[model samples]
Target: MKYFRANRPLTINEVQKFAPAAFADKASLDVSKNYSFLSTRNLIETLEKKNIVPFAVAQTKSRTDEAKESGRHLIRFRHENHKLEIGEVVPEIVLETSHDAKSSFKFSLGLFRLICENGLVAPCSILDTIRIKHVKADDSDVIDAAFEVLDSSDSAIENILEMKRKVLSIDDRFSFANEATTLRWEKESDCPHLPLEKILAPRRRKESELDLWTTFNVVQENLVRGGLSFYKLNDKGYPIARQSTRAVNSIAKNLELNRNLWTLANKFLNN
Candidate 1:
């Protein structure tokens, strides 16, 4: 499994060379000169001040290799182990993506449990994302967002511990899985009306824990990266049980699912 696709960080000059169109024209030059563009150097310097360093940087290219859509800089912060909780902390790269022929810049925060290293993006309800339009990009805002995420770590970690303490009953697990299915499908009619036994089946024995935290992770992984298989008719008109692929869905789906699941967990704790 290749976690970090780009292992080396590309300099701003190198990035400009790789995608000259992104830096072309007088407007681009003005943006670049004003430090309004969040370059790799800016990201490196901001993170380094907090003692966080990027381990990998991947420059994603379009299908035709004619354009660059985004860059992913992977960084793993030092894991913290408290008497009540233990987990790995990871932050995602901030980058711009082409949406509807326009550039949208944003960054996400994530976590990986030391017990399983199952990476999950922080739910938006718990942590607000930083988004800046390419035209009005501000370096200060970007840096502030980074600091905000870093500062919220303690609260996030406490929530994780709270979730771990809340054990899921068999019925609770089933209800959670059903809700997960609803969130996974855009349309209610398109959802599979299978038994919770099939839907909540763990991908591995290690994920069989009854705690809300573990159950959430199991369902999350299955939803984002398909795992559980069901029999479906192939072109041959024969039913076959094929294992699901590990490919992830769109960023929107990722954020939606995470937010929904986090909300569900919060409800459980409150009740």
Candidate 2:
């Protein structure tokens, strides 16, 4: 619940100090120099306005306290200059149809990390989740691999590998997210070649185009009319099922991990 923003470049140790649950392999790489936290609420709102459906796992206050009190579940995300860092949350990755296996999904929701302080979410490419050590954000470069495009006819593995090489060669920065893996990109080099800039940039302008009042009204109507269902994880890390007619709750359910943590942090800070 405590939203942590980086006042300065955060070392792994520093992040661990605030949220001990952060990934384990903090020693190998200097993640402290990069990445920041983001408000999950603001992040989801931004995504929804852009019409991007991001699938995420919900954590409650229990998880929140576990992270803040002992830094046991801390995860980090790296981003550039506070742009929309977390990529499109892939909804296809289903961990379970039932509730018991939810934690599996929690770990699979891409490696995107939230910078608690400024609400700046970033890719958690460089940090190792199990060992919690830092690795090359772009292992595609170091490891020489290819990524499978969600849907592409010409997207062969070889092509993906080549693209990966080129991207990592340029943008040395690595991004981490939820899915036990890393995504590497070389910004300047990759963008011009494939319009990555246009594709990657968050539709910030598109969000601004919508009149806030109108958007909220529409969202409100959907909440009121729609059969809304969600799993509300409280500070104790317990799932609470309820119905709501609030767009905000939708945002909360979608990006619940960040929301629950942020909620707990706010509660702790206020109390």
Candidate 3:
């Protein structure tokens, strides 16, 4: 999965267990000679001192052991000391980086929705992130990016309130779930075999409400966490065999899907 979540701050051993490349001492091969290695471990340690803790971490999977050591990683953080008592949904900052030269050190806003117990990656920059090349970046830069994110409690609450206030009709909810299927399974896949009612089903009592936020969360959890059932088609377009979907495993795809879902949720905002 994209995240190895923890109830408490993780130790170096725990981090490496899930994302060893976070401790990589050098950059991946084929990069410019000037490309410097930036240790995600060091950055986490620095942020820890500032009361920001790494609660979740993950690295890309590899077919070969050698490639595994240089995989990209993403670590999600929260402030332990100055944490906001935001009831069900708390904010988090997610930072993605790599030694493979595939991506830069990207920082973005995330949310810890305790109601469903899932962490959401907010598409907008609630806390502004830096965009410079990783080679010239320092530990202080991440700290600054984090500080900006933690400073925006108002916007976070406002966004959540907007979703909660908007109620959805049955067709609207179905449309939301349908678009989500395209987002998750891609437009070309046989995702239509998956029923909208299955995606719309609530996992808990609170989620049974017809609010947009609840429906969005319902579709998101079902899509990302998998578990729903479907079937592949035969050459004649008939049912072939039964199959269950799989949870998102890649850190890169996880972030992309989450961001797209967030953007999808926003379409309701202007309507």
Candidate 4:
């Protein structure tokens, strides 16, 4: 997938370069006659009226010509009320849909930390998932649903606070990182084992904390922006040449990994 992200809201032209699907006026020819065309641009305009503006947008690289303009795309926006202060967790609205009839207008809550690089803070708790089936675009519903997703911030914040309050010992922190590696590569026995230390180290001094929140952020950023090196032994027990993990950009894979990481964090929180 190709994506554009920033601390400030992205302009339509900027978003268009990454996700032309957002501007498509008609549904894909593959859709049935009953399928109604709902433009993502209309929904974005509707939400912007309520001060919910897009900060990041992305789409899959389409292979077929017909799917080029109707492929799945995602827009991540934040409410005007949320402060974009560095090192603080902020709430956001994640919206995804496509005109190919393969996706519906789905809305979910997200959290982000405004560090120098603008790392995403995965949703810590179970948040509402709003799905709108094929229908003519309506502003009122978009506005209401956006606010409803934003309302989930309270629970998200609470979860973050709890994670911060519970401090972890060095060994515990490494354990968390170890589990994160498994989440990234399920059935590690079948894959080259990633070193826990690579993901455990924080990029900034401020992020080096023995708490769940900070630890989660460190691991999440490393796993998502992967360049970690690990060696795997081949059939004869001879080590294969060093290989680096690739950054995850597939929409489905990224979402699944993030949610899995979130679930792993919660399990540690409760124990």
TM-scores of the models, in the order given = 0.70, 0.24, 0.90, 0.90
* Model 3: per-residue Cα lDDT over 79-108, one tens digit each: 765443433787777888888777777877
Model 2 regions lying over 4 Å from their true place: 7-9, 23-74, 79-102, 105-208, 211-271
What is the lDDT, from 0 to 100, of the residue 227 in candidate 1?
A: 60
Clashes of each: 0, 59, 0, 0
lDDT of 4 by residue, 38-140 (tens): 7788877877788888888989989986787999998888876666666777888887789998988877787777784543535536674777778664545
Candidate 4, residue 98: the lDDT equals: 90
Instruction: Tell me each candidate's RMSD, in Å, in order.
Output: 5.8, 20.1, 2.4, 2.3
Clashing pairs in 3: none
Q: Candidate 2's residue-wise lDDT over 141-176, tens digit each?
A: 211111111122132223222322332211221111
For 1-271, candidate 1 gives per-residue lDDT tens digits of: 1234222344445444444333322223213333344454565566666655443233334454333323322233332222213444444433333322234455556665545545566656567666666555656766676666666666777888888899988989988888878878768655544456766777777777899988888888777776655555555857665544343434444555766777777777667
Judged by TM-score relative to the true structure, which candidate is superior, 1 or 4? 4
| Top-down TM-score ranking | 4, 3, 1, 2
Can you rank all candidates by lDDT, best first? 4, 3, 1, 2
lDDT preference between candidates 3 and 4, better one: 4
TM value for model 1: 0.70
Worst 10 residues of 2 by lDDT: 174-183
